[model samples]
Target: MQTALLFPGQGSQYIGMGQDLFTRSIVARRTFEEASEILGYSVSNLCFQGSEADLTRTDYAQPCILTVGIAAFRVLVERMEREPVYLAGHSLGEITALTASGALHFADAVRLVRFRGMLMRDAQKHKAGSMMAVHGLTPQVIEKECLEPEYRGLVVISNLNSSRQTVVSGQVNALTKIKERFTDLGGHVTPLQVDGAFHSPFMKNAAMQLYDELRLIPFHSMRYSVLSNVTALPYPNVNCIPSFLSEQMVERVRWQGCVQFLMERQVYNLIEVGPGSVLSNMLRREKLDACMIQSMDKKEYLQKLIKESLPKGNRAVSYAHYLKAALCAKNYNIHGETSNYLKEVAGPFRELEQLARSGDVADGNAKALEALNHILDCKMTPAIQRGGILSHIAEEGVVRHV
Candidate 1:
């Protein structure tokens, strides 16, 4: 069955979120290291060891969560053999989805989100605003009440989270008034613990700055369809992604609508591929059987997808190429020079490619498969090898060395 990958945004991060993946997967560690070099601060430190206050800072939080989310995603791809049929991310996660789909390169995504966070933080300096979650009400009711003239001060619906859950953001006074009104109307109102009025006009300045920054980044055509937060629809074209992302800063996250869009497309299996079960919880509330990435039964789930996604029949050469591609992708993600231990396994990787193209189908397949097994089993450092999270081989029920 086809699946859709859901990535969470801010408020989903916590200490040690992706540490397990980083410890277990070479590709995950490389992603963290690459981001650390780009930002000149240890993203791994911020995610794994930083104080809650430090992580909550807009500038720090965006990059930290993005890095962790992407790290988990990379590790997920390495562990599983399936490709997602569609992608959707909440707020900052939209960028993550783009990065995962090849629309934005990893390095470019790290830089862009850092700048985006800075701009949003600066916007808060001049405009003091707040966000509140209004539950037990539909979008129409919340939007109508927000527009009522009595509690006027720039309040607008910020996130359409679900049919019965919507968030509002704007000036504090306006939000307070709306909260009181919603409570009196029997709606549950919980003020969000955010520093700025995100997804509202208060973010106009940040939106403009983000737009300017987006122009400098090259967004390639998406490999998988990504539902846009601003439009609540699949992006018409990749070229439009920049503009949509720019508007996303001040546009309500039409999450409910995005979910509806996915549902209309028959996406029943929605797997959230990042930290926290927030998105999965939200989807479950919508009666969808959504699953999170870091489950205890991850190996079983990973194996099932791998069996489906792996090429079949005469695709032996194609499978060989996939292994090489995975290796090269991991290579680009490495922080410093290749380690001598990894270098020791490079010969087998090279041989796999050679054997695949040698035109002897039977011998080539056997050699390529054997070479892959050797490469995956090659040893590295003791520290890298001994981790709480170990990749598994379903067939042998043994820990994979990769």
Candidate 2:
């Protein structure tokens, strides 16, 4: 199936977000550890045990969310055989998408986002703005209202989440007036848990500072296409990455457009690889019923993917059977020492046979190679004889099956 990966932004974060991925997958654990080492703090601790108040801070939340998104993506890479055709993120998630696409090194991306978060927080202290989600309103109506004489120059639509939902960001007073206006027009308004009016003119200074940070970091060619939140299109070239990323802070997130573009390309499998199901819920709201959507927010979801990706049918069993027969046919005691044969070859082969019978392809395949090593290590077996057995096993697809 053609798949696209979507990463969630700041509001998706919470206490104990990535704890499951951290505990269950070594790749995920290493990703968190690597971020912790680079940031000089335990990202795992923050995601798995930090308080909600601390996690809500832009400086902390941005990095924490980025770490979790990338951790889950890494675990997915380790477990699944298929690769996504496109990648996209909501807000701070765009950075996560970039890191996962290999356009930005994980270490550099971590420090850059921490710096970006600090800049945004500083901007919030200076300007003091907020964001509110306006539901049951079309983008055109919200845009028209923002351009009115009283609300104009005060608030702007910051997020085009869907046909039914839009987010506005601006000064506190302006947002209050806009919220009242929107509510009177039968629109439901809910305040977002954000520090400043992100993706609006209030973040211009932060965006400029972020541009300088982006300049210092080197961006590589992406392994897969990544859609920009600012343009809702695939990045045209590597040179535009820094400018487009910086511009994203001050431009509305065209998430609805991004999803539409994916649908146009016939990409049906949408996987949200992050801390929460916010993106998945958003897609559902868009009413893309024909698409298969999934969220890797918990360990159970990751386990499901792993199970589905396992080799199917009797190929694994057949390989296991062939190996067992070969091992039994081989004489481990060419030197006439039966004790070495019993300890080395017999024990490991028995374990491999049990794994094969259990029908766990991954484990059985792993144990088969390990058992082969044991068989080759028997001191009583002649070196020439061992080579002959190894060649025969290779011919039987032992290595290829794995």
Query: lDDT of each prediction vs. the true structure?
Result: 0.70, 0.78
Q: What are the per-residue Cα lDDT tens digits for candidate 1 across 1-402?
A: 566788888877777777766765556677788899999998888888998888777898889878877776655554443557788999999999888776786889999999998888888886788788888987788878877787544889899999768999988877877788888888999876567889988888789888888988866556568989988888877788779999999989999988888788777667777777778777777666443323311445444543443332332234445354336432222222346436646787778567657644332243444455335333311112212112311222322222
Model 2: residue 364 alpha-carbon error in angstroms: 15
**TM match of model 1 to true structure:** 0.75
Candidate 1: the clashing residue pairs are none
TM-score, every prediction:
0.75, 0.77
Weakest ten-residue segment in model 2 by summed lDDT: 393-402
> Model 1 off-target regions past 4 Å?
289-402
Using TM-score as the measure, the top candidate is: 2
Q: Please, what are the lDDT tens digits per residue for candidate 2 over residues 1-402?
A: 788999999899888998877775555676788889999999988888898888988999999999999878765753454568899999899899988776776888899989988988899886678899999988888899999999888899999888888999999988988889899989999998888889998889889989988998876556668999989999987788889989999999999999999999999999999998999998988889789999998557777864543344332234465356446555533533466347646776677677667665442353565455445434323334544444455444433221
